[model samples]
Target: MGWIKNAKAATLGEDARKAWDAGSPVFTPILNMPSSNAGLSGRVEDWEHMMAAVLAIGWRLHTWAVCSDSRGRPQAQPLFVRP
Candidate 1:
């Protein structure tokens, strides 16, 4: 995501306001000099690393269902019982 911003900045060049006005422009990944991350090693690749670690240590993810009551109030109910 940061790389995309840098790419847009390089393309827009010196006019940050124009880039901001562009409003989350779509960027294609390319081997550009500005966004190039060279000589980097041992970088964490997966975004779910922490989640995986938590689950490994006996944590479980639960699913919940949210519904509206008769008075238009929100209520949540767990969909399953976790052991």
Candidate 2:
């Protein structure tokens, strides 16, 4: 199950606008993959939805790499930038 496939553009746009207004680089929710599949699909889906919205509004993906969470757990944290 994925939300992106049925996500409303207007809703996504609103989220994007909020992030843009915040004036900080947007980061996707931490993604813990093969090590743990729990919520992986949903996280990926949300990431795709957010990416689509951001790109549509002139934001670009500036970084896509692994990062450690607060607990030092490995995960993917994609950073988006505007410009």
Query: Which candidate number has the best TM-score?
Result: 2
Cα RMSD to native, each candidate?
A: 19.8, 5.4
RMSD score of candidate 1 (Å):
19.8
> What lDDT does model 2 reach?
0.60
Residue 59's C-alpha lDDT in candidate 1? 30
Q: Runs in model 2 with CA error above 4 Å?
A: 2-5, 8-13, 25-47, 67-75
Q: Residue-wise lDDT of candidate 2 within 1-83, one digit each (tens)?
A: 44534464456566768878788666343444433344344454444555576678777778789766666655676666778
**Top candidate (lDDT):** 2
Clashing pairs in 2: none
**Residue 4 lDDT in model 2?**
33
Candidate 1 structure, TM-score to reference: 0.24
Runs of candidate 1 exceeding 4 Å displacement: 1-61
lDDT of 1 at 22: 53
State how far residue 17 of model 2 sits from its true place (Å): 1.5
TM-scores across all candidates? 0.24, 0.46
